[model samples]
Target: MPLDGQLSTLNRVYKDKDAQDVLEHALNNFGDMALVSSFGAESVVLLHMAAQINPDVPVLFIDTEMLFAETLEYQRDVAAQLGLTDVRAIRAKRETLFEKDNENLLHLHDTDACCALRKTEPLQRALQGFDGWVSGRKRVQGGDRQALEYFEIERPLGRLPRAKVNPLAHWDRDDLQDYIKAHNLPRHPLVAKGYPSVGCSPCTTKVKTGEDARAGRWRDQSKTECGIHFGANGAVRAS
Candidate 1:
């Protein structure tokens, strides 16, 4: 079946089912599907879920090298605690960085370009052999995420569209917390400091009370995604 057709059938079949059911279905059908995680504030929930289903499921952690030290530590701790065997650390080639962002100051000038060099490009290369992947995106996050579905197509430009499974599309903030608490999942250290939506340290700020959880990302900028997911509106693209 075509990517769109597969998405339609999957979403319809699992429309009212819980996130676990959807995740299990994806793991069974999508051969060699990787779980691409930021391992940020809410990542441990999905990480735990995937661990329960299959501890060895490949987890791709994009190490932008610009991330907070806490995020790096959390990634290691979560994988160890959950027994995730194949947690891959993906990063841009050192040569690429030397050519494009030697100073690591590209973010200070062009955020998108910096992301392309450090995030989107590296992730795409790491995902080359996979049939599809999973993400922890939830609809309650708002903005481009509000219209997310159980399954969607992610075209990484120049490559074939890959199946992107979003099992947590319908889950809310409380749902994540409840799951974490129930599972005794370890929380990311930065979350206690008010960085609700954690990203690269240079681009992330502390969110104030009453502000959107993601308000801290890119601070005063209009950018949301790091471009690894897809085009504007978040990942829809030409096949």
Candidate 2:
């Protein structure tokens, strides 16, 4: 079957099922799958689930070198607590990093370009040979992600078309918290300090009361996403 046909079948069957069921189906059907995680406030829910199924499943972490120290620590602590042996830290080449952001101020100049070199490009490289990838994106986050799906095809430039599995696409904020509580999962330290959505250090800020979970990210700027995800099928609405 073609890629679209397979994607449709998977979505049709697992779209409304439990998140773990969706993840399991993706793992069993998509060969060489990897789970990309930020180890952010709500990341432990998925990481814990993945750990339950297979501790060795590759969990890709994009270390943009601009992340907060707490995020780095959380990444280590979460992986250890979950016994994820195959967790891989993905980073951009030093040479390219210097060429693009020699002063480490590309984000000050152009957030998109900074994310391109740091997060998006490096993750694309790390995803090579993987038939699909799992992410913690949720529709509750809103904006472009409000329409996310359990399964969709991604055709990044210069990369093979693959599946982007978002098991939490339909989960709401309450649902995430409930899961985290029910499982007694490790929490990102920043969450207690108002950083509901953690990203790179320079870009992320503490969310103010009554603001969205992601309002802190790229605060005062038009940018929301780090540009790590998108697809050719027009489902991804990043901007």
Candidate 3:
């Protein structure tokens, strides 16, 4: 199918129901589709939803080699409980890391470069051969993503452009919590410790009262995202 036709079909399906149904429909239509997960707070909801519909759908888990131990544990636990069959762990290339940025302090001086090496580069590689992928992003997450759409085109591996689906784009924080609670899904351990938004160990912190959930990630920095899902012209996608 042409990319435009695919986009139109996805948009029509996504407009028909809530996030979970859209996700299931996407997986049903595109058998090769996968879900990209960070396994952070509230991540299990989507993971469980995907598992319920199709346990064999590939679940791409990016292990940046800098995530919290609790996050890793939660990832494994959720995958097992949900019976997800294809939980592929994507990782950065050691040679690229050593040769490109030997100091390992690239994030401090150049976060974009560091993310390109650690997060974006690996994810781009993992997305190879996929027709499309799903993300847990919601509009309420704030930042430039405040006006997110259910479906958009993405350049897989940051090169070969393809359709990208955000099934939970319309869901809010309360909706997520309710889904998890109703399903009795396991929560990320750090959430109870006040870290509403979990990312890498070094970059994430606990959120303060009245602050946005994602404020803790890359605190005090101008950084909003790791730059993986942007356009070729360097425009960030709507959250």
Candidate 4:
């Protein structure tokens, strides 16, 4: 089926359904589906829900090599707590890193290029055999994602287009907090230190009291995303 048709059907069927329902439906429909998670502040909500439905579902975690030590530890702890047996840690190739960012300071001059070298490229390679994947993006996150849908298509770099499912597209911070509290899920360690949104170590900062949740990420930069999510026009919005 075409991308639009697939999106329309998926939205129609799972439109009013909650995140868990959308996830369950997607996992059953897309046999080779996987969950691509950052394991950031609110990642545990989706991970826990997925574990409840299918603990064996493939969960892909991108370790950008520049991520905070807390995030790395959280990834391991959350996976074990959720009993997610198929959590795969994807990393950037050493050769590619050496060629693109030999000094690891590429993010200082060009965050997009650094992300392309570390995140987008590696994820594209890791998703080779999957027909579809789920992301934890939410409309409340702001910017381009404010209009996010339950189902979409991601045109990743150097990879065939694949179905991208955003099960928590409509969820808000309160909804996530409630879910986590209800389930007794563990949160990323940095959350308490005011890092509402965690990404790479250098790029991520602490959000102030009145700032947006994601204001800390890539602070003082025009780059909103790390070149992973796709735009509505089927282009990779690598920034």
Question: Each prediction's Cα lDDT score?
Answer: 0.89, 0.87, 0.82, 0.87
Question: Clashes in each model (backbone N, CA, C under 3 Å)?
Answer: 0, 0, 3, 1
Off by over 4 Å in 4: 232-239
* C-alpha TM-score for every candidate: 0.96, 0.96, 0.92, 0.95
RMSD of each: 2.4, 1.6, 2.0, 1.6
How would you encode candidate 3's per-residue C-alpha lDDT over 1-239 as one tens digit per residue?
Answer: 87757877778766768887788777877647879999989789889888889899999998888899999999999899999999999988889878987776777787677778888878878887887899888889877677777888775443656777888888888898889889988889999999998998988889989998988988888788877776546635223
- Model 2: residues >4 Å from true position, as ranges? 233-239
The lDDT of model 3 is 0.82
Q: What is the lDDT of residue 77 in candidate 3?
A: 90
The runs of at least 3 residues in candidate 1 whose Cα sits more than 4 Å from the true structure, single-residue gaps closed, are 232-239
Per-residue lDDT of model 2, residues 1-239, tens digit only: 99978898888877569999999888887899999998888999999999999899999999999999999999998899889999899999999988888899988989888888988888888998899999999888878777888998887876668998999999998999899889888789999999999999888888889998888888887777788887554223244
- lDDT for residue 117 in candidate 3, whole number 0-100: 85
Model 2 residue 221 CA deviation (Å) reads 1.6
Quote the RMSD, in angstroms, for model 4: 1.6
Candidate 3 is scored at a TM of 0.92
